[model samples]
Target: MENFDAIVIGSGQGGNPLAKKMAEKGWKIALVEQRQPGGTCINDGCTPTKTMIASARIAHLLSRSDTWGIRNQGYTVDLPAIIARKNEVVQQFRNGTVKNLEKAGVTVLMGTAVFSGVKTLTVTMHDGSIRELTATHIFINTGAAPFIPEIPGLRDVPYLTSTSLQEEVKVPPELIILGGGYIALEMGQLYRRLGSTVTIVEKSAQLMSKEDPDVAAVIKKILEAEDIEVYTATTTEKISGTQDHIEVQLQTAGKSHIITGTHLLVATGRNPQTAALQLSKTNVTLDEKGYVQVNDQLETSCPGIYAIGDVKPGPAFTHISYNDHLILYKNLFEEAELSTKTRQLPYCMFTDPQLGRIGLSETSARQAGYPVKVAHLSMDKVARAIETGETAGFMKAVVHEHTGQILGAAVIGTEGGEIMSVLQMAMLGGITATQLRDMIFAHPLYAESLNNLFMTLEK
Candidate 1:
């Protein structure tokens, strides 16, 4: 048996940094990963998907070059080349992660790890050898995996998830996607731009069901204009077909229908990846949904054991996971007082015109019983959007009427993510909408539109 000062299972966004930080502090540490070192973000989620999204955006823009008077033709997407480029980017980031761990003197272990006792773990190495290791503190950052719903015949037929779809080199002639969340919208736009006939079936009443109906409607309009079919309030009954072709039987609004396509992508949701961790053998308790239960300090029921990122019940985002690492490191090692509570929640969905959001939505603010004031502006009215000919969405903000404070804001146009950050900073600094409207912003930029957007609410 071997012992270490600390052991971090799963080299994900949280574990990767925390392990390196601990090792650099002169503590012997062990980092265990069953598969790749970079976890979901570098290997499958943010890095690779966004890289492919960039290709899709280029293809989309080239297809409309005539509108810009470019007079271009014979545009086509080279699928294998795009895949190669994405693979190259992923590899580069993964190598950097491994190098960071090695530089900090972390003992990298390639195997599956499970708790045999409190602070004790047994690893089945990748080469079929078993090793026993113990540590004074253990951290579980094993992220979640794609959840394949139990629809009849869905599993029997070959289907792609968010992870597997990125590796595909061949663009399907006809693609049918399940779910209407961020993953579905991203992949749907990606394949549609790559010359595939894309159709999205969402069980919810609208795309991005969590967003306000008006916000969701704007996205639906943009996608429908791109020739992508979206069916909402639809339930997928079953799937049947071979690898090359698939037929999905579904129901929407009491009507039954069948949609056939050359390929199918499932983006329903994800569940915590804890079944193999053998948590029952330890004192760690899981929530009803199977996510590891953690206090505000991110410590599990077990005294020194901790869980973070998607493994715990929180928003699944790369930035949030990295913040988890920061919170854990500061409080535990630096003797600083901090917590996962009362932090700003900011997220962006990387579609054609990104959906950048922070703080409360209009619905949530109203539901919370706050008298809310709203301002909405279309992108076509913005000087930059009109000048660049990329106007296809809008910007909306929810404010507290009495407090004159900005509550939340959502941007759904070109560079929406960047523009949303301005509002996020204002909220963080306690700047009201009136103050922001009166502030001088650079001319003819997307951000300048904020003045007009808030001006409408001044009344």
Candidate 2:
């Protein structure tokens, strides 16, 4: 049996960084991965989705080139070319990830790893050979997979999850998406712009239900304007499929409707990738939802065993997973104080006129029993938005009425994701609205929206 200072399971954002940090600390480390080097974010999730979104956005603008006073005709989006470009981007990053891991002196074990016992792993190599390794510490960063509900006949039907959809190069004439979160919104828009008839079925009352109701409404309007059919407060009663097309039986508001599409895409939520790890052998515990329970330091119940990313019980974001790396690394080597509880993270949905929020929303703030003051500003009033012809959303800041300290912010507009960073910093640094209002901002920028938002606050 070979022993090392540390072993990291799964080579995604979380595992990769932790392995490097431990190795840099002069610890012999083994990084195990069953698939490609980079985790889902690089291989299937964030990178590919964003690349496709960029192509779709460009296609959308070109389709409306006449609005820019350019007389263009016979514009078409080359779906296969877009898919080819996405694949190239994914492959480049995957190769880079492998190169970096090798350069960092981390042993890359390409196989499925299972817990033989606490602090021990039995890896089954692709060639059908098994090897056992022991370590003082083990980090589990196995990410997540798309959550498919147990609807009758849904599994046997031909459908694509987010992972499989990334590998598809052909565009179907009609696509039916089942969910209304970020993935559904993004993919729905992409397929629609790429010349596919897209339909979205959301089981909730509002799409992007995690966002504030007003912000979600704005996004809903933009999606409808793009001609992507959206059905909210609906449920997929049953799904039947032939080799070429899928027939969906759906019910909404006491009415039954049947929709037929050439392709079905499931954009539901995700569940932790822990089933394969066989956690029963370790002291690490799982929550009711199957996510590994970790403390603020990212340490699991088992000593020296940590969990990060979607497999852990927290927000599942790439950046959050990266933050988990920093926390674990600091506690292991550096004397610097680090914990997940010390950070204020932000999340954004990448759709046209994106939706982003950090800290708390107005609803959550009031529910927490704080005397909250709200400052809401519509993007129509911002000069930059009017000049760019993208004024279709709003920004709202929630603050403590007495102290003027920014409590939270919710934004929905073009460049919403970029603009949220400023508010996120303010919330993290405990900056006040009065300070933001008095700060000099550059002229004719969407960031000036924050200045306008703070100006409306009651001092």
lDDT of 1 by residue, 1-459 (tens): 899999999999989999999999998999999999989998989999999999999999898988788888568789999999999999999999999999999999999999898889999999999989999889999999998999999989989999998878889899999999999999999899999999999999999999999989999998999999999999999899998889999998898889999889999999999999899989999998799999988999999999988999988998888888899889988887788887889999999899999999999999999999998899989999999999999999999998879899999999999999999999999999889889899998899999999998966
Q: What are the per-model numbers of colliding residue pairs?
A: 0, 0
Candidate that would win on lDDT = 1
Writing each residue's lDDT as its tens digit, candidate 2 over 75-167 gives 777777887898899999999888887788999899999999998999999889998999998999889989999988799888998878766
Reference-based lDDT, each prediction = 0.92, 0.87
Candidate 2 residue runs with Cα over 4 Å from true position: none
Candidate 2, which ten residues in sequence have the lowest lDDT sum?
67-76
Question: How far out, in Å, is residue 157 in model 1?
Answer: 0.6
Every candidate's CA RMSD: 1.1, 1.4
- The local lDDT score (0 to 100) that residue 145 gets in candidate 2 is 88
Per TM-score, the best of the predicted structures is 1
